[model samples]
Target: MKTKILFLLSIIVLGTTSTLKAQKLKKFGSSIEKKIGPKTIKVPYTDVVSYLGYAAPGNEDEVKDGKKFYYIYVWVPAVAPELGVRMMSPVGKAKTKNPIKSEAYTKNAKSKDYFDTYITLERSDIISADNISQDAVDSANWVILERNDDSGEMPKQPSGSSYNSLLRYKSDINDPLKALTVGLYRIGFTTYKTGEVKGTFLAEVAAPVKLPGVVMAKTIADLKAGMSK
Candidate 1:
């Protein structure tokens, strides 16, 4: 009788631990939808590029509406029908594939700090790859295509809230400015509320089609340099 009681207690404890571990590993990425007869289901993207970055003090690109902003420039080499962008802060034990890391991120990979992520996908007027000079980038007009403050699909933050950001923008062929043409784009990120944004983050950009030769950089000069290669 005593042995049976001990065995039952161990099974219950193991089941509880497994449940908690599974809950902690619930992470969602960008996805599309497919129809199977009378039902529709979402499918994750095949091509995903991840970037791990760190936002330190006094390293913001600009400040708007009393909030500090940072940007990651991306060069789209081909036209795509849809694009997806998402960001999560404090990048805790998350597994990523071949993620690009910045200098700050490499230096602070072990830092235990993060922030509430707010993100936007913007398209610039510079369309041609040959015209991606610094002068053109400086004079280019950028238009926001999508913005996300809190995403339920994202995993919960340390604060137990889904404050991460995710957005999917479909190209509008009717509108030239809104179309996803071969051009320059950027991922702008900041905090949802007015406060300092300091932490390690994982940001990803995905597309339904294969986007070869896509370049991502931390600044305009870096983006231009990548395009020149």
Candidate 2:
């Protein structure tokens, strides 16, 4: 009788575990649909044009190896032909008296610093409805801008900018989203000329609303095992 009772208890525990897992999986799926699903935006450069944007949900306040970070999605337009956008960050204050010796100082610094910057696109060959492929979209470049020391806002005039450059997401271990960190970032067109016509948009990195895809996948697997038992 005791052996039979033990067996029954084990079965009950297994069943409970499975039910909980499945519930978590469903919740994750719903969250993804709401946050990272397909989105359409009008490419700002053209008077009237549209492009699809796809992004993955990010995690909030993720702690690893004694470091804190917040992951957020950075998106790129699918139909941008000749124009490319990148992320920028402010040049840190110079610590050395000689500007040339300062690591933060650069040769390509902009003229006047604007507290609030604008991003615009220009010199485009043409605008069309040609949809960019998933592979191309996945491989597109993204920017990571550092947050201001005093505020969450990104610096208006970046001392330096990244255009058509590779980001951490490209080399993330297993997932690109893992490369995102807590900070303020800018999304704007890449231009050769410093004062060329352009527009800028600010992206604030914060806590995520849902679990990442990897976590959700593990939860679903656990749910399956529990249900099978």
Error of 2 at 138 (Å): 10
Evaluated against the true structure, the overall lDDT of model 1 is 0.84
- Candidate number with greatest TM-score: 1
List model 1 lDDT by residue over 133-180, tens digit each.
767866889999999999887777776677888899989999998999
Candidate 2 worst ten-residue window by lDDT: 24-33
Clashing pairs in 2: 60-207, 60-208, 118-199, 118-200, 119-198, 119-199, 119-200, 120-198, 120-199
Error of 2 at 61 (Å): 32
* Number of the predicted model whose lDDT against the real structure is largest: 1
Residues 41-140, model 2: lDDT tens digits:
3322221111111111132123333333322222222311222222222222212121111111123232122222223211111112132233433344
